[model samples]
Target: MNYKLIVVMLFLVMGALVEGKRLANLGHKLKQEAEKVGKEAGHILEGKVAQKAADVVFNAVLRKG
Candidate 1:
């Protein structure tokens, strides 16, 4: 019974780790896309205010961790 419980716990931990990794990857992709869009928008707009707005979005999409 104890060995079975340990095995189950191990599986749970592994699953959690996999999910965390997937989420991290997703976040990275989101940031990359946001940056690309932000840059494109800034170029298209061609104004200080628009560039500032794009900068705001780019910074907001960045993760601190």
Candidate 2:
């Protein structure tokens, strides 16, 4: 009976370890994807800001002329 209990405990520990590893891997993948998306969003925002700045400058120049 003691040996059976030990075997059961071992299996449970191994299963838990495997599950933990899987969750860690999934978290890593999600983080990478979020970073990629963040970079793309940053680039898009930068472009928009630049365009708006240019428009403001162009309008200012036209008004002066």
What TM-score goes with each of the models? 0.68, 0.93
Give the number of the best model, judged by TM-score: 2
Q: 1-65, model 2: which lDDT tens digit per residue?
A: 69999999999999999999999999999999999999999999999999999999999999999
Candidate 1 differs from the real structure by a C-alpha RMSD in angstroms, to one decimal, of: 15.6
lDDT of 1 by residue, 17-60 (tens): 99999999999999999999999988777887778998988888
Kindly give the stretch of ten consecutive residues in candidate 1 with the minimal lDDT sum: 56-65
Once fitted onto the true fold, the runs of candidate 2 whose alpha carbons sit more than 4 angstroms away are: none
Which predicted model would earn the best lDDT?
A: 2
| RMSD of model 2 against the true structure | 1.1
Residue 39, model 1: lDDT of: 97
Residue 39 displacement in candidate 1 (angstroms): 0.2
